[model samples]
Target: MKERVQKALDGIADLVWPRICAVGACSRAVDRPGRHICSGCYSTLPFYAPGGACRICGAPVAAKVSHLFTCETCTAAPPCYERTCSVLAYEGVAEELVKAFKYNRATWLAEDFAELAEGAVRAELDSHSVDVVVPVPLHPNRQRQRGYNQSALVARSLARRLNRRMDESSLVRIRDTPKQSLLGGSERRKNLKGAFSVVRPAFVRGRAILLLDDVTTTGSTLAAAAEPLRAAGAAHIWCATIARAASTS
Candidate 1:
């Protein structure tokens, strides 16, 4: 009875102070429990159709070959991770969400992104056979300056939703490379090479790892991060990003 009374009280208080959508006012109320975005705004967000994307790289492929085979790009140069999934396209409102999490340090948005991502990622997560979740590491100095690693924040929520153990400490950014956004494809890959390392091989060895990133543009960052895990003997590495960009570089 006491617990019920507290629940009722909380509900009453919430009614007085309803949760608003994270995006600037169209004044839509957030009704999804533990998420900040409302249905109307969320519907406008550019979500990828999971079924029509490459099973290996999450790139959109011709409808006939989507799940049946690797896309031509992946066939020519396969990424380090075995498979990938993304929740949204990196455009318009979706891009704003990612930028808010990244540059603006809207840490609370991670929860909302994770909630949006779970359904989009569930099939890939299931297919990947992951035993652990790992977030791409940010250089310690950058993390210190930013006050948080947005990738890790998203990964933490994703791990909780998927019931996987999250190992934030296993992956370390050994070198602080410049932002990949400003670089060409080759330059991005070159910059990220040897940037990451595994602090604890024992933790990852023989485990299927799910790597999480907030956004993937050219796949260079994810590939670079996966190499260290591969060397550490992670049996298989799968990746998921909240958004996929149309290659700004």
Candidate 2:
């Protein structure tokens, strides 16, 4: 009875106060009345093809080789994480939505973002192997200022959808590093070299970690965070992000 009542309340709330959708104004017609984004918009969002993508980094590649589409950079120097996935190209409305979530504290869009990510992850990976979900953590000060970690919200939603354990406290950001967006790749790597540490190593040991984040440009931050988990004996680390910046190099 309580569950039914709660469902009724939720339905009433949706009817009374619909959430602001994420589809752009031009695409508003594509959205359903109370949803975050319309099915059409969701369909139109850019998706990286699973084929001809780097086996390790998951970046798009021109051709496949040796049962993997290895990006040139990954071929030269590999990232720490075993695999990575992204939903959209980091531009236009996608970029704006990410900025709003991370800096403006527009957490209402998290569910929509998670839905998009979940689809991409399922398409790219076999879900049965995933054991835990971990969000990239922010330093305490930044987290307080922002009112929440956007990554954590996404991670929680993903955990619920996948019916997997969430280990938010397993990994932590011990150092406050300068923002990497403005820096070059080398500097970004330097900025994040020692920024992350695992708090409860036992929680992640022998488990496959599904790491969530908002975006990836140089991938320094994700790699840095993965280092600690890798050191703690994580079996496999797979990263998922909302978008990826197009690399000029």
Candidate 3:
């Protein structure tokens, strides 16, 4: 009885407040019912292909390799995370939707982003092997200023889809550093140095972790966040993101 009532109420609500497509430019009414993005917009979105990408960093390699190959950059100076998986290239529709979700308070887009990222994540990782999911933490001040941690929202939805435990409190950002977007790759790494701390090491100790983030540029933020997790004795760490910016090198 309650389910029926709730469904009816939701139906009425949708009629009163129709959902427009998530793409900023394409303000079309969503073609798929209950979906955030329209089919047309989603079809044009730039999804990432891992065929010629570096296994460790997900960066595109200039030359195709026969087998799983690490890029020269990753081979020279390895990141803390062993591998990375990302769904979309941070461009066009994907970029607009991410900005909306992160900066404009479109929290409902969390589930949509998670849904898009799930297939890529599952293809690259064994869902059964991931013991816990952890979202890259934002400093308390920043989180408060933003009203919510966008990464945490995505992580929760992803954890639900993966059927893994999510430790939102175990990893914390101790320092409120400058915006990573404004800094270069090397500067981004230095800005976040010693910014993260682990509060409950036991929670992630000896457990495989899937670190979730909204996007990846130089991967400095992900690398910095994983430092504390590695020190806390995490068995292994893999990074996943909704989008990845084009590699500069």
Candidate 4:
């Protein structure tokens, strides 16, 4: 078939001309097919070590008490979502990749991000069945300016890899809130209050949803997004993020 021939040609070309790493400063040649980050650079990513994070929020804890270890903060006030699976700590290369994919229009990195997060996602999915994959929605104005929603792109790739249906329209950002990067956790929660609305309640009710996002700090954004879903009668909501910010305290 012509499609097969083109794929073969592309594979051959990759061997002949290695692709450059996605990291802006580290443009070294990568030999892996369909991978933009070189193995050496990839090794430097801040992958979360097993049992080092809170099971509930995926935040790094001093030491995990059990498989269901919940951090003190999460134990005090649980997030809207049932659980979170984070692939990397938001520092070093992980932070760089998220920023580039989110703000610089480096949409191609979505596949790479999805691949990195796939294992954690699968681990979570193994215990609970998710009926739909939903990306944290971006305000129309912000999405129009960026030309794409970074989370949606990654969610689409993840959905394909997991063989799940992706629903991007059910969740909508109704308010154009201030950037959360500059705000503290409480302030960020306030900013996102009433910002999200589930437009299609029928599609989500009684369905277990896998919510996707690029990065999570205090989890305010993911929690806010899940609030509307919870109100709409979503059976259960679980969140996945490429990276989670290192605990400040």
Candidate whose lDDT is highest: 3
Summarize candidate 3's per-residue lDDT along 93-150 as a digit string, tens digits.
Answer: 7888899999999998887888887787889876679999899998999999999999
Worst 10 contiguous positions by lDDT, candidate 4: 59-68
Q: Candidate 2 on 1-249: residue-level lDDT in tens? A: 975786588667867765445654643432343246667666766665534667677666655554756677877887778888888888777787778887876787788888888988898876678999899999999998888989899898888789898888989999998887778888888889889999899998999999988888767788999999999999999999988887553
Q: Give each model's clash number.
A: 0, 0, 0, 0
TM-score, ranked from best to worst: 3, 4, 1, 2
The residue pairs that clash in candidate 2, if any, are none
TM-scores for candidates 1 onward, in order: 0.89, 0.88, 0.92, 0.91
User: lDDT for every model?
Assistant: 0.82, 0.81, 0.87, 0.85
Question: What's the residue-level lDDT of 230 in candidate 1?
Answer: 91
Model 1 residue 71 distance off true place after TM-score fit, in angstroms: 3.3
Worst 10 residues of 2 by lDDT: 26-35
Q: Which one wins by lDDT: 1 or 4?
A: 4
Candidate 1 vs candidate 2: the lDDT winner is: 1
Q: Model 4, range 1-249, lDDT digits (tens) per residue?
A: 975786688688788887789977797887566677888888888886655667777776675445667788888988778888888878888888888888888887887888887888887655248788999999999999999999999889888788888999999999999988888878988999999999999999999999999888888899899999999999989999998885442
TM-score of 2: 0.88
Compose the digit string of candidate 1's lDDT tens values, residues 77-172: 887789888889888888887888899977779888888767767865673377888999899999999989998998887787888888999999
